[model samples]
Structures are given as C-alpha cells and as structure tokens.
Target chain A: MTERSGTVVGPRPPTVIVDDLHVVYRVRGAGRTKEVKGGATAALARMISPRRLAGERRVHAVKGVGFVARRGETIGLIGSNGSGKSTLLRAIAGLLPAESGAVYSDGQPALLGVNAALMNDLSGERNVVLGCLAMGLSPREVRERYDEIVEFSGINDKGDFISLPMRAYSSGMAARLRFAIASAVNHDVLMIDEALATGDRAFRKRSEARIRELRAEAGTVFLVSHSLTSIRDTCARTLWLENGELVMDGPTDEVVRAYEDSAGRRSSAP
Target chain B: MSRDVIPRHGALDPEVGAAELAARYGLGVSGARPSPVEYTRRLWGRRHFIAAFARARGDGQYSRAHLGRLWQVMTPLLNAAVYYLIFGLLIGTRDGVPDFIPFLVTGVFVFAFTQSSVLSGVRAVSGNLGLVRALHFPRAVLPVALTLAQLRQMLVSMAVLVVIVLLAGQVPTWSWLLVVPVLLAQSVFNAGLALVAARLGSAVSDLAQLLPFVLRTWMYASGVMYSIGNLTADAPLPVRVLLDLNPAAVYIDLTRFALIDSFTAAQLPPYAWGVAVAWAFVLGVGGFGYFWQAEGRYGRD
Candidate 1:
C-alpha cells in the first residue's frame, strides 16, 4: 500500500480526504431528545403533545466541512458546545454516516470521546486488555503493554484501583483509563473529544508526549478541546467550528485568536 | 485515515475529484460495510476476544448477589423447583409422564439457554452502544459473547441436571452422553436467535421490553412442564406433528430421551434428530446472514 506513490519516504502524505461532508442526525421523538434549544417553553411544548409534535427532526450537525489531514499532522478542533465538534469527530470515525458527502480514509479511525466507555461492569485492567484486543492487538502485545497502560492512566497510583470494577471509578479516572488504552497503539487517525480534559498535569504532559510520538510515527491526530492551552501546546493547526460549520482552519494561534475575539464580540454586543 | 499521509498543502480543489484522489492514494470510503467474506475473516480474528469477553461477563453476571457465584447454579435450580410445585404437584403435569422432577428440570434447563440467549441478544447491540461506537471490532461479537455467557450458566445448570436425574432413580447409561451433542445443537439455535434478536433490537430498542413476554409465551407453548405427546395425543395428526416439531419441544424431548430410561423405552418421536439439526442449520446460517446484512448500520444515528 505504501508503494502507491513516490512520497513513501516523505513523512507527510494525505491520509484522510473529507470533501464537502454533511451530517444530519435524524433523531426520533425529537420533541424532547437532544434538542439544541433548551428552555421552559420548549419543554412545555414537548410535554403537552409528544406524539403529535414529535417527528423525525433533522439535526444539521456538520455542514459542507472539507479538509485533508496528512501523516504527521496534529489538528485541533475548537468549537463552543453544540457546535458539531463531537459530531464531526464521530463522522470521521465512521460511527455516523454522511448525509450528503463522504469521508475517505486509508484505515479505521479511532475516536475516543467522553461518552464512550468500554465496559463499566468490568475492572479497569480488563478494560485495558479488552480495549487493546478490540483494536486488533495480539494477546502477547496487550500483556506486554498492560503495566505501562495502567501506570500511564495513573488510576492505581493512589490505590489498587485497577482491580476495582469500572463502575466504582470516578468520571475522571474512567476518562484517564480510556485515554491510556486508546493511546497504547498508534492509530492512523486518532480523534480525542474532550477526553483529555480529565487528567491531572502530570498525566496531561504524558499524553501530550504520546501525541507527539504518534505524529512522529506518521499518524494523524485530531483533538477537540475547550482548553486553549492544550490546543496551543499540542497542535500546530486548529479548525474553528461554529454552529455546525467550519469557520476557520489555520494555525493554532491564528484560529484561537480569531475564536476568542469573536466570543468577546458576541458577549460585548449584548 | 491512511498513514502514508500525502497532502502537505492539505487543501482539496473545489473541482478536482476527491474520490479519485483518495483512491489513487489507496484510501477506502469510511463507513462502508465490509464484504461478507471479509466480515467473516475479521470476526474470526477476534475469536479470543470474544471468548475472554464472554467469560468476563459470565463471571460478573452474579456478582451483585449475596451468594455471588453460587447464584449461577442456584437461580435456575430454584426456578425448576417452583415449576415442579405449580406444574408438577398442583396441576399434575406429571400424570402419565415418568420421572416428573427430572423431566421438568431438564425442560427448564434446556429452555433456559434459548430464553436467556434471546433476552441478552436483544440488548447485545443496543445496550453496548458505547463499546459499539468506540471500537471498530465486529458488532456480532456482543451477541455471540452474550450467548456464550448464557451457555456458561447453562453448563452449570446441566451439571445439576445429571445429579437430579440420578437422584430421581434414573440410572445413567451411555445414552446420557448424548446431552453434549444435544446441547451443542441447541447452542447453535440459540446463537442464531440471538443474532436475529440483536438486529431487531438495534433497530427498535422497545423489542427488549416485549421479548420477555414473548419468550414466556414460547416457553409455555414448548411444554416445559407437561408432556407434549400425552397432551396432544387426542389432537389431530397435523397439530400433533406440528407441536412435536416445535424446535424447543424437540430439543427438550431429545434431552429427556438421553437421560430417562422410560423416555427411551417408550416409542420415540420419528426424525427428532433430523428436525432438531435442521432447525439449528436454518437459524444458525440464516440468522448470521440476516444480521450480517446490517453490519455497518449498528449503533449509527
């Protein structure tokens, strides 16, 4: 596969080509489910006559966003809540279908999101083993990396938390374990959605190093984060999304500056 | 997301064919379902993961109970005891049927496999949306693992089955070994039902709520407490044949013949093995095809 072009030796080659992508979430019983609009009257209207009011509502989550991600590129996605950041990541991961366009990629993209847990009833150790195995790692490989994964997640630092079932874990600890498991191997395109925000400073530094190592191995990484400091520290490029559209795609400093300025303007206008 | 990432510019021309460009770089369309052959291969590669996951879930299933793992053997035994009270003693389902306790226990244990398989299969995909969306492994693994977990429970139940028959004064013979093949055939049937249920449940999650009642009705129709042959003796030939051929009924009847000397001594139903194996083949292969048809659609929005 790598012999396809002369750029095999070159570090940067196009790995993902997402052209004119559109994602509309067709939610059923939409009178109350995941409504972007949240208020008292909306709630009242939904509760009054759900059957008559609830229909398949199309949530235009990602609209006409196009980008090409190559090997060795770490792209940061910056958007306010409800701005389709998670939806876009999910679309790239192939968990959601494209409503209009397409996402072309060389291999499977692993999307690690806050809402995705492996198994809550299993122990943290089992999750690591299962998560690695699910990603197609051999048992020997999983065993070799088992201790490193636990130490990286740091869940067992304060106590023997690895043996405890995941249901007993705090949300932060769960997220940390998920991150550690996902980062164990180098995925062609690894997308992290708000999952990295739960770790402490030491863990954050370790994960940032892991991201850089993945990039060095010619893997593409996409990170969606509210932490501007994280974006500035880890990603060289950033995409700004607002209301399900890609408003800006450029250097991290440029896009973050533009995003902050627009937020300031919106706040000052009222 | 191809690792041989090419575009240094990272820009797509509005007019240039993006599909052609991606294909030229050996990229595949994301979210496209794999071909049937490829799907099988991928599923086969994860066989160990499937087994490990099944064992984990089976061990954890009864962790909440005070007696813990002991409940695995006790819960179904208790259910059998209750059925014996209501159906065996009160209603006298044991009439004209030899060794009523062993008979009822066998029916309960055998049908329990299919019952739990269907129940867990209904939730296999819909319940594990997090794992489904988060990982790229075959979604079929969930249902298969759930069936395996039920099979683990049934294995313990079957052990208790042998002891119960011995206590009921039914001497164990070489034919008792037939339970292994019978259980294997029933497992295939149960796995197939689970696959079918997983597909339906993934589409309409409310199927999980409706399935228990449906399974209960099926259990009654399959004659877990009474002898189908005795009850349907006076019925029409067509109805008798049809009732005897019910997959669950055939499996339970086969198990009875294997364990009880009277059942083997009595005139056995014609072609019971033929019909039982046929059900296994049809559901096992057909259910897999049906579930595989919707491979890419699971856990999607």
Candidate 2:
C-alpha cells in the first residue's frame, strides 16, 4: 500500500476518471435447484428463444461509458429515461461500482436526488438537521447554520408544523427543505439528479442562485435533468446520453439546440 | 472559513491538469493522491458528521411510535417482563438459578442490544440506499449510528431494569462499578456486528427478511431466559461451543457475576470476555476497513 519511491504516494488522481463503466443487473429465480435448472435450460434455449430466455438475464444499464471531469466547469448529463444518466452519476459518486472502469474522484463527491429525502416520518425541522448531518456537516456547523437553512426554505411561517413529520408537508415544501439542507453545504464535487423538478418558482430561483454560489466556490457540479431550460440556465457544458451512450458533449446552448431540433424533426417526420 | 485557504483540487483547478500546480499550492493531493492512509484520514476527519447523524437517527427513530421516546424504556421492559413471566414464573425453569428476576431481566436487556443489532443492522445499508447515493461520508457511520441509536434505547431499558431490581429487594453492591466496563464491552461487540451486517445487508437485502427468524433461534440457543447450566451434558460439543461463541452468553454471565451469581467463578469462563472483546475488535476494525474500501461504491444502483 506504500510507494517504492517512499514519498508517501497518494490515491490516483481523481478528476472523475471513468473508463468503460458498465453496469449489468442479473435477474435470478428462487432456490438453487430451480435456479440451476433454469440456467441450464436458458443456456440451451438461447439460440431458439433468445428473448424469452429464463434465468440470469442481464440488463446492461450503462455500457462502456467513459469521461473525465476536471475542476470548475459544470457538466450537464441530459438523457431520456433509462438512458444511463443516473447510473453514470451513481457510478461516479461511488454509489455503484464500475463493472470494467474506474471512477477516480479527488475526494468524496456529494450526490443529490429526490430519493435522498430526510425521513418522511420526522418533522421538516428535524429533517433539516438530519439532512445536514447526512451531507457531512458537523454538529457545530449544523447548529450555526440551523436558522439559515430554515430561513432559506421559507417555511418558517409553517411554524410548529416544521416540527411535524415530513409526511405533513406538500411536495413543494419538502423539495424546498431538501434543497435548503443540501445547498447549505459546499462539497468538493456535487451531483444533482433532477432535484430541481419539484421546486416552486421562487424556490427554483433561490436554488439556482445557490448552485451558482457552489460553482463559484470552486466545486465541480453535475446536473442531470430532462428540463433543457434548467440545464441551459445552470450549466456551461452539457452531455447528451441515449440508450446508455454519450451521444453528445459540448456547450449547453449548442447541445440543447441540437437535441431539440433533432427531436422536433423526428416528430414532424412521423 | 471565509474563503477556503487551501487551493482547489478538483475540476476547479485553475491551472488544469498541472500536477505541480496542485502540489505547489498545497491542495491536499488533488485527484492523484495514491495513499489509502491519507484517504482514510480524510474520511475519518468527518467524525463530527458521524455523531451528528447518530443523534438525528436516534431522535428520528424514537419519534415514530405513539408513546414516542417512552418506548425506549418500555420496549426492553416489556421484553424482560414477558420473558420473566414465561421463563421465570410460568415454566418455573429457574429452579437452581439464584436471583431469577435480576438474572433474567439483565440477560433480556443485554441480549436485546445484540438482537436489535443483527436484526435492525441487517438492513441498515440497503434501507438507506437513497442517502447512500446522495451523500458522501463514511458508510460505516451508518451502521455505527444505528448501534448508537439502539444503545440509547437499550440504556433507557437498562435504567428501567435497575429500578425494577431495586423494587424487587435487590441491593446495589460495590461490584456494580464493574457493570460500566461490562456494558462498554457489550456495546463494542454490538458495534462490530453492526459493521459486518451493514456490508452483508447491502449485498443481500434478503438477510433483512431472514434476520428475525435467525435472531429467534439464536436467542434460545444463547440463553436469554434460562441459565446455560440447564442444558443437559448429553448436548453435543458443537452446541456447547456455539453457546460459548454467543457474545450474549458472556454478557449474561458477566452481568450475573456483577449482580447475583458470584459463587461459581469457575463455571463463568474467563475467556468469554476476551473472546467478546476480540470479536468486537476484529469485527469493528475489520468491518470498518472493509466498508471504507468500498466507500465510494455504496451509491451505485
């Protein structure tokens, strides 16, 4: 685990070096006997009935995706549903392992997605604390920024309800709180997965402003969204993905314009 | 804190891709640092984050039930009472056991910690898959947080057990101080299990579904209610070793030594504490190491 040079070499540089990242899911049947039986039959039947093949069917979510994220510039991953945008994000965040590639992050990268909500059973106020802690803020940091988080969410008027479980809050309210908790802290790199979708207009304005601040503070940000407007507004560059492939990568406006033009042409042609 | 004294290391590096640029500016290894030691040091430096999360999880977990935080005391008390009624009074199984109520109650409380650990911990990672993907902190912290949360509840239950003991005519002895070290040992043991469970739990979520059944079988085997002496000599050697492997047994025997059963020092194996501590360390340090090795991987769907 040490270097031969004896200069205390560190982990390989982490400019998000992802080379040929592949994710495959295998669906298996119950019981060893059944699984074994199914596997043998599936293997034998592959030639005749490839689509209906039973046992150990693999779904490749991401296929041989590679990229490098340097410091400063935001990368927008634009893709259709199931296009491997989220998979690529998760892989880079180290949430998912690269089947054949490597993700060398300089340090831990923060990922933001709607699924990462504070416990719905706890009040928004408590959720703010939980979210902050989950985001790697110290207790002292949380205590100091406690009010700022609440105020940013603009749900202070909700009062004692803030102490109520998140189940009581509306979708917009929860989104705002989630954003407030997440954006309150700056990460070395932050990945946002369509978190901006549920926020109201005012909250979107605030959240966008916060994202700008994060970018200005020398953090690398990855925004994955279907909303071209959001990506165009926030990101300098955009990555377009289709069927688990990086279809395009360039300036946000140029990529978005091309993507829109292509989709419009297809619709009109049909 | 005003404006990040340290230079940036990620894609934000102004002199992009220049190794000397990051090194000269002292940016803390940027993306090229190869030493796992420094990598771990950076991860461990987030200790305060772990504590904050533990508190939030403990408070959030307790706030769910109708009785809210009171269930912390009531849950173990209820388990103890049920076992005391069934094993102590109904079965009349503690014929040779000295302090039946205290003995059974302490065993119930101590074992409850371990039981919840394996049971709740089996899903600790998978259950928080969402958070695992979004946040970047030590994944071991999740399991450790769960252990601490459960410990808070267990401590409340222990307090209630102590009151019940006092009411039942048991007097505190000078040896009560030993309980502190014993409890600490038991906690470390549980934390170790938590670490291993978190990794295993994430790998196979089915372990979570199977935990309750497994814990039930383990409970009877480990002597949660009756004394281990009650098992007949004819019982297989493997069964006896299995009993010995039970950290719960060591905890129960230690608690008994502290509270009631002092005469049979030979019956209480000296190696039990050592085994428990060793297991705790092996599992704790080993589990954390294993978890950290896959630190950036937990977020993968």
Candidate 3:
C-alpha cells in the first residue's frame, strides 16, 4: 500500500459496498413465554404444558441498510444506544454474519474497538508486539516500528508503565495504546468503535490526525461514536441509524443537526 | 436521506448469487470463507504469530508460581512419585515389570503431554474469544498455538525424564534415538486431537466440564501407571489386539520401547511403527480438515 502523507483530494474508487445487508441476533430465552404460577406446581406445569418454553428472540440489529464507502472517505456512524451502529460496523468488517444480502470490500477491514484483543495480564510492551503480529505484521516490522508505536501511544511519558501489566493502565491509556497499534499500519478499511471516546483532548487530537492520515492513504474508515462533536470535527459524511434503520446519510452538519433536533423533541415531549 | 443521490449501480440485485454480484461490481465479498488451499496459504503466512504466541504462553505458564518453571518438571515428577508409592511399592504391581520406575515415568510424562494438549485445546477457542472477535486471522492458529505450547512443556519434562532414565541404570543405545521419532509422531497425533477438541468445545461449551471425567477414564485405559500387558495377558485374542491398537497406548508403548531396556519387541503390538504412523496421518490430516470446514462459524453465535 502506498503511503500518502497529506489529504489527496480527487475522486476515489469505491472500497466498501454494503447492499441491503441484514444482521439479526438470535438471543436465547429473550422472547416472552407464559409465566408459571407457584414453585413446584409451576415446575410440574412447565414440564407438562403444551406451550413451547422460552422461544428464541431475534433481534433485528441491522435491517436492509445499504451504502457505498469509497477510498479516502472517513464516514461517521452516529446513533443512539441499541441503534445498531456497532452492529453495522461489525457487519461491514465481516466480524458478524449478515442475515441476508452482502458486504463487499476491497481489502480486509481492521476493527479497533474498546474491547480489543490485548491481553490484560501481559505488559504493555508485550501487548504491542502481540497486537502488531495479530494485525499481520511480521516480526521484523514489529521490531522496526516498536519505538515509534510506543512514542505515538505516549503511555511511557507518565512513567515506565509500558513495562507494567496492561491491567495497571487506565482505560484511556489502554484505548490510546490500542489506537496507536491499529493505526500504525495502512489498512485498506479501518473501523473504529468508540475508542476515541475514552481518550483526553490531546490523545483525541492525535487519534484524529492519525485517522486523517489513514484516509489520505486511500483507506476507508468507519467511525462509530456517540459524541457528535467528534463526528462533526472528523467526518465529512455521517450516517444516522435509528432502531436498526438508516434514517439519514448525508453531510455531517446536516445529519447531526437533524438527529439532535429529533432527539431534543423526543426528550422534551416525554 | 435521498437514496437517489448515492449511486446504487453496483448494489446487489437480491436475485444474483454473491459471486456474480462481486464479479459485476469488481468487489471482494467480505466474510467469504476462503477455499481450503487459500486458507492454508493464509495460515502459513501467519506462522510467526503462531510461534510467538506459543513461546509467550510457554514462558508465562509458571509466571506467578513460587517455584516458577521448576514446577513444570516437578508436577509430573511428583505425580510419578505418588504413583510409585501406591502402585509400585504398596500394591506390588511392579513385580513383573522391569525398571518399573522408568516405565511408569515414561508413561506418565508422555501421556500427560497429550492429555494437557487436549485439555488446553478444549478452551483454545472459547477462552480466546476476545482475540477471535477482534482480529481477522485463521481460527486454526489458536488451537495449533496451544498444542505447540503444550509440546514445549512436554519437551522440558522429557529432558528431565531422560535424566531419570539414565539414573535408573539404562544405557543409551541406538534405539534410544528412536525417542525423537516417537515424540514427533505423538506431537502430530496430539495436534490432531487438539483440533478436534477445539471445534467440539467451541460448539458445546459443556464439553469443557465433561472433558476431565472422560480424560480420566482414558488415562486409566491407556495404562499410564501400569503395564496393560499384565491386565490383558489373560484376555481373549481380539480384546488384546484392540487394546494394543489403542492410539494413546500405542504412543506410550512406542516411547517406552524406545527408552526402556526391559520393554521388548514381543510386548509391543504387531507392526508397531506402521500403526503409529497410520494413527498420526489419519488423525492429523482428518482432524485438521474437519476443523477447517467449520472455520467461519467459530466465535459467532
């Protein structure tokens, strides 16, 4: 992959295509069932009753959502809790199975979530190596970028905590380290799920700059964050999902304004 | 909100197959399961990750222990000691067996190697859901890496076993070199079993709870502490033949025959080397293919 330093402004080829994708989560015992009355009698009743016990609940997390993501585009996914933003991102990254329809990507998408795969029992330095290797970097490349990665994360500046177990690091510190490791490579498609929400202003600034750099390298980025300010500052395009449906996909300012307006109305009315 | 502004020229028609759609749009299907050959190639590319993970796990096995890595060699030795007291001294099961201490130690160490690999394999996928969910690599790496870790542990314990054998007054002969090939065969067999266990354990997590009881029965049947010959000497011909063909017993017997002077060729099963190689080939290749077939389903509900 060629590394482009600054923003390359031009028409870019499409890198990710999601066409009428549907993702449903089958949660066991989530569906309603007839309640039994009292202790032993209820247990006996459940045993003999013709009514089916504890049906599977299908959570339609992503329903027929479709969009095209181009190289050099940084897209923001904004939604309320349980609105399928994370599910959509996961489906795009091919981590979650699509119930129907399809997701097409130009290259393997790298997903960096708050619950990333770093071992908490291992030291930060070890985690850096493991994380890099997990991302398909060779041993030599990991050694080459070891210092640069630690410097980018800035976890060592506070002290020598890089040698300490990751369990000792604060959540912000962990998230920053995860971001640093993930952004070190030039991914074809990069998805960030609320990793930036935990970091402070300076870390957030650095992370945003890194995202821009990844975009400039012709990488498609899908960022899911609850913070609208971050979305407005980082993404030119915003997708608003509500209850697993794509409510809007447009310029950041317009979609964010409309989403906030509706949210405001709903809260005021209630 | 206008769908018209965003071009849907290459959007799926819902009628065409995914491959056709990809061909039309020149897009790669995300989450597509790779062909078997392709999957193997991908796995081969991540060989470094496998080795690194195995080394880290092997080193970290005793990180928190008071005695540290001494325990790796000590745990099996202590087990051997207790077995020697019970089965060898008090029970007098060692009457017929020559150099019973070396015999028992070899059996215990070799059997424990496969036992621990299978046990660790049971949790390989379920325990590493964090890695499986966050990263995009072949799931086979988890089980294979785990087997490698157990193999390293077994190697350390085997080094100690060599010293014990030498102390037992057994001279190193040309046949002793056969121990290398025996271990290589056992590693292949254990890796295959690990793959099978990883798949089953991931599908039904209850397998983890039930595995110990099953393995305990297996350990008893494999004759880890005693010679199966003494128990089966009076049995029917077919029963004796079946016991001889038992894969675990076959491996343990091979190692014993290689390392112990008292273990003779007549005591081993007919065509011992042939049986060992066949078991390794069947289990190693077959188990891997079976596990690979379920590659896409791992870590997903």
Docking category for candidate 2? acceptable
lDDT of 2 by residue, A162-201 (tens): 7778888887787778778888987778888888888878
Cα lDDT of model 1 overall?
0.86
Tell me what fraction of the real C-alpha contacts between chains A and B each candidate also makes. Answer: 0.70, 0.36, 0.44
> Stretches of candidate 3 above 4 Å error?
A1-11, A29-56, B1-21
Global lDDT of each candidate: 0.86, 0.69, 0.82
User: Please, what are the lDDT tens digits per residue for candidate 1 over residues A129-225?
Assistant: 9899888888999999999999999999998999999999999899999999999988999999989898888889999999999999989999999
Pick by lDDT: 2 or 3, better one = 3
DockQ of 3: 0.34
Clashing pairs in 3: none
Model 1 residue B51 CA deviation in Å: 0.6
Q: In model 1, which regions exceed 4 Å deviation?
A: A1-11, A30-54, B1-9, B265-267
**lDDT of model 2 at residue A219?**
81
TM-score of chain A of each: 0.89, 0.82, 0.86
- TM-score-best of 2 and 3: 3
Tens digits of per-residue lDDT for model 1, B29-90: 88778988898899889987888889888988876777989998899889998998899889
Tell me which of candidates 1 and 2 scores higher on TM-score. Answer: 1
Best-to-worst order by TM-score is 1, 3, 2
